[model samples]
Target chain A: MSNEVEETNSLKLVTPGHASSETEGRSVDAGPGDADCSPDGRVPYMMSQIQETLQTLDTAVDTILGKVEELHSKYEREGLAENPVLDACREITFACCFHDLCSQRLNIVLKSLEEFGDELTDGSNGTREEASILASVGESETRSATQDVQGGGSLLNGPAMTGEGLSQEDVDELLKSFEEFN
Target chain B: MAVDKNMPVLIVDDYSSMLRIIRNLLFELGFKNITEATDGREALKKLNRDAYGLIISDWNMEPMSGYDLLVAVRKDEQMKKTPFIMVTAESKVENVVAAREAGVDNYIIKPFNGATLKQKMKRVIGDF
Candidate 1:
């Protein structure tokens, strides 16, 4: 819709279908909007209007940049960088809003994995394991999206989780060791 | 009596990561047979399709919450005697009592350890 509006404005500056043809070096008799064309073939009024539209586009770009900056700052202030739930919720919201921007959603998914570090920082000591586990799982999509490593290197791959080599006793011992460390 | 390792365990939670973690933790505890559902409806479907010896569920989930799942399980002739445990982030004493009244064999609050999970499972399913 906005593209149609912009194209219409550009068309008003020249003959509608001839606009591209004119740019490609094909000359046509000046239309009503091109009356300011000089005898030598330069259209001063049309050139100035094009320049003005370019300036407007430049300003619009600047405004979008400013809005992105403002959003980033607000996100920082909200502590979304440190909260898994907030990060995941924001990622989903972004995906919904910018449905066409697959790269944006993918990046958000990867960045949200930092919640794993947040979990480690908060640590599991004396916290309700079920809640912590739930929170961790909620953020797991992010971690999975960013997983470049293979061979069971994920957080799931504890020492006892030796890429399917260890026995159940080894897993228990690993859990015990992790518990002791925590 | 010992838990039947061959019997499938049904883990119900709204979060996928928690399900994976729980499944892995159960695997570590020597229970290799496990299945998961994201909510009560899926859980009920899975329960109908398979015979699960034990169920671990989260209280807050859509379309047949853990509480609803427990009630449904108890009402089902085949699953009536199966052990049910509620794992939830809601830590209120009243909530625990309500779960107990709903026929939950055990309950665990969130942020629990693998040891706590194992102990709870042992209490419900008998020693491994």
Candidate 2:
């Protein structure tokens, strides 16, 4: 079966030349039967490739970690407790009801909005106005909820906006309530 | 006749930021006595403890929504017929219809200007 070839090829280990030198004490090609088949050199060869790949990955991971640390330092230097995205999420339950201002500082939020907008347009693009409107709608809801909780009122009472019709009686009741508020 | 200035207005929402925003907005608009609740259940608790002239609520929430709050407010003997408005992001026609059926006094869309809010308030207050 081709699977056997794949398995064998997959298992062929290639060690880095440096690694091979470091581990020269270990006779990697000690199998006597391998003498007939180029000393089964495939194993060490593949191992080297894998080790190189791993090194690359490790270096990349370290670079990313360093970048994150640098970003953290930047936030601290600017006197921000955290990055804007984290700040905005935390504010969802505590402060900064108007997420629009916060989102301005958060690249992640902008990226997410861009992605969402792309998906909404089905890749057709050119819907900046639509995306902006939706973003505002989201921001308004966030603000309302924040304001309601801060006012010691239930979360249900914040001012929300949407394009919807109002009936006369409904208006009457609100008007009546406003009466008492006045 | 002006509504008693001392009468309280209860505003509820799930987000603290919005709670502060609306409270400040209301205060700037001359609403001096205000209370807050984070959800419908909490609003009900506050309602049971005191009287309010107006209730402004959001429609969607966790642990009891504004719709639930409106129904409860209408059902309570002392709170029934108290003025209530449904301020919500659910701008669907069906949602508004439901709010109207449930007895919302007025509806205003989001991202509203202070003038619009004041206009709505004047309409509700009748004296403004």
Top candidate (lDDT): 1
Which digits, one per residue and each the tens of the lDDT, describe model 1 over residues A116-151?
434444454445565478676875644531121222
| Candidate 2 interface RMSD value | 11.8
Q: Against the hidden true structure, what lDDT does model 1 obtain?
A: 0.57
Query: Residue B4 of model 2: what lDDT?
Result: 68
Q: In model 2 chain A, where is the ten-residue run with the lowest total lDDT?
A: A1-10
Local accuracy of candidate 1 as per-residue lDDT tens digits, B10-121: 9998655456557656764678889989988899999999888999998766555677788788889998998998776544434544555567787765545566788878
- Per-residue lDDT of candidate 2, residues A53-78 (tens digit): 54554455445434544554466568
Question: After TM-score superposition, what is the CA distance of residue A156 in candidate 1 from its true location, in Å?
Answer: 29
Please tell me how candidate 1 rates in CAPRI terms.
incorrect
- How would you encode candidate 2's per-residue C-alpha lDDT over B68-128 as one tens digit per residue? 7887887788998888876654444445545665667777644344555566666676653
DockQ of each: 0.02, 0.10
Off by over 4 Å in 1: A1-182
What share of the reference contacts survives in each candidate? 0.00, 0.14
